[model samples]
Target: MSTVDQDYQLPGGGANITALPKISLHDHLDGGLRPQTIIELADDIGFALPASEANALGTWFAEKSDSGSLVEYLKTFDLTTAVMQTEAGLTRVAREFVQDLAADGVIYGEIRWAPEQHLARGLTLDQTVEAVQAGLDAGVDDVQSAGKTIRVGQLVSAMRHADRGLEIAELAVRHRDAGVVGFDIAGAEAGFPAGKLREAFDYLAKNFFPATVHAGEADGLESIRGALFDGRALRLGHGVRIAEDLVLESEDGDNSYVSLGPVAQWVKDREIALELSPQSNLQTGAIAQWGNDLIDHPFDILYQLGFTVTVNTDNRLMSNTSLSKELFLLSEAFGYDLTDFEVFQLNAASAAFLSLEEREDLADQITEGFGRA
Candidate 1:
């Protein structure tokens, strides 16, 4: 059976979690394309792939990404990204991404991808955004046509190592009225802090645009500091490593006392949303300092501490997962029940880039969905 078909009885066979309404805040466009689509698109563009058949290609991605080594894990993106440079490839991928999310029971999803990475085919930055927006619009329409409703928005991304931050930020502001919802910085988080895009953040701040930075994943607290101080990020992309800020004060048997450092204190007090992806976090070694198991993940600690913790599927294809599976894994590892699952969904609904009314509506939908479940 496909992974999506595998079902888990939620604490008493309450309901299949996959049928619950959810919000996806951190899914990547380039990382969610189908292997079949890649093969077809590659053929259309005269590009080569590691495998010709769809199932073999799919296994190829899962096998390569399971290597545990960070560099090897990232190599899968090279194949996916290579096929995503053209307008045809980008649109098709974006469309399928939305369709897949709908199938996974995501009512709303914010799809993020870097325009700077799609310039190889000679499309201008503005042209790239338009192409993605077009794809997103078609996907939403298709979802509605299928007798299901799913809303999607583009989170225009600028590569931190590249020099197009300011340009991409402007491109986002320019397309804000047309499907673009927010801004983000991705790619190589070690040396390239959000401060490198100070000018872009400044522009976004002036325009009152929302920003989410990839911090505390490959790097530590310092990178997260740059994201908040420089990017003024409204949300954190994979802020899992922020767990480093907690200093264990004492432990007595099963009860361990911890103190929040300045950074953790600020994040918790401010209620900044942490976009935590369970599967990808383990694969990328984001939680290696604590341990490799999901039980070692700080998600429960951060949640219990009242941080705005939300679950996400960082990259569906790379991780071979969905938001439903992430929640399921967390439940199995931590003994979380339906109430805990509801909190994560509510947190995501509240942190979504939508307006207050829409966020409230999403919360209501989640509440009703879970209540029925």
Candidate 2:
């Protein structure tokens, strides 16, 4: 479409992953801004970025995010978030985010961002949501005008370290009819467990709302357990470490065998989706214990064990990636073909926080597209 097919051959040539229909389950809104857009927004607000040139600013984000420390990686958001404190900035960024996702062939996506982080400009939390919705709506309209349809939902996030979980959860439910789809608790997950927002999760549950918590990435089984029990999360954000519960016995040439402990069994049995960001996982050292390279990721193992694994670009600009790029990297590392790639999309479609009808429609769209590919 944009002369960027995102398709690439594997060691053994076949279909390119970029031409395949994709669903992005874990992309972040604030983390995916264009470098040029950042420069303009920062300029409009009289704000200074780490670099004046867009290319230099892009390099700055990449460098900071790959520092292998969660706190250091998170520092990049400070600059991105700094420019997002106004209505114009929020709307423009949101609209552009969707347009870019559409360009990447992501038919459906869920964008998560913290609203509390955008109120520095005197806008109320509800006002910030409205501004972002305006942008997202514009982006959707832009897609339709281009003869390509893309749908997006906002997973309004409450910074876990802050005490505004209940308020943000209510904000999400208040905007439920207006593009806001789900609730999430993101931020430093090590010290702040999902249980910290027990009141908020309980409220979401009572209202029949859905949540997806950032767990099992910074913390361990206890955090994941809390997300399931306390947060009542329908899906796990980057729940890669659930593989830590997997115990391997042996593997031969033709076949391999392994056993799942209680945690792993429950996750698989319950069919919780894992939003695995391959490159982000590698950069953040999330998979450091397994290996340094992409091949060392537990994604293939989780997929083989019947876990609902979905591919994502947790932060596109910072990781210098797109949904297509992540798929290409995965295929290169794991020999994935069209069928394997389609399975990932199907998994994401099923895990999307959407109505049964919408999910089914998305599944049909994915299935039909993949059929053509």
Among all windows of 10 consecutive residues in model 1, the one with the lowest summed lDDT is 1-10
Cα lDDT for residue 165, candidate 2? 94
TM-score of each: 0.96, 0.96
Deviation in Å, model 2, residue 156 alpha carbon: 0.4
Go through the candidates in order and give the clash count of each: 0, 0
lDDT of 1 by residue, 194-256 (tens): 989999999999999999999999899999999999999989999988999988899999998
Off by over 4 Å in 2: 1-13, 252-254
Which 10-residue window in model 2 sums to the lowest lDDT? 1-10
Residue 238 accuracy (lDDT) in model 1: 95
lDDT (C-alpha, whole model) for all candidates: 0.88, 0.89
Any idea what lDDT model 2 has? 0.89
Off by over 4 Å in 1: 1-12
Error of 1 at 292 (Å): 1.5
lDDT by residue (233-334, candidate 2, tens digit) is: 889999988988988788898778989988889989998999899999888888889988999999998998899999999999889888888888888888
Predict model 1's lDDT versus the native. 0.88
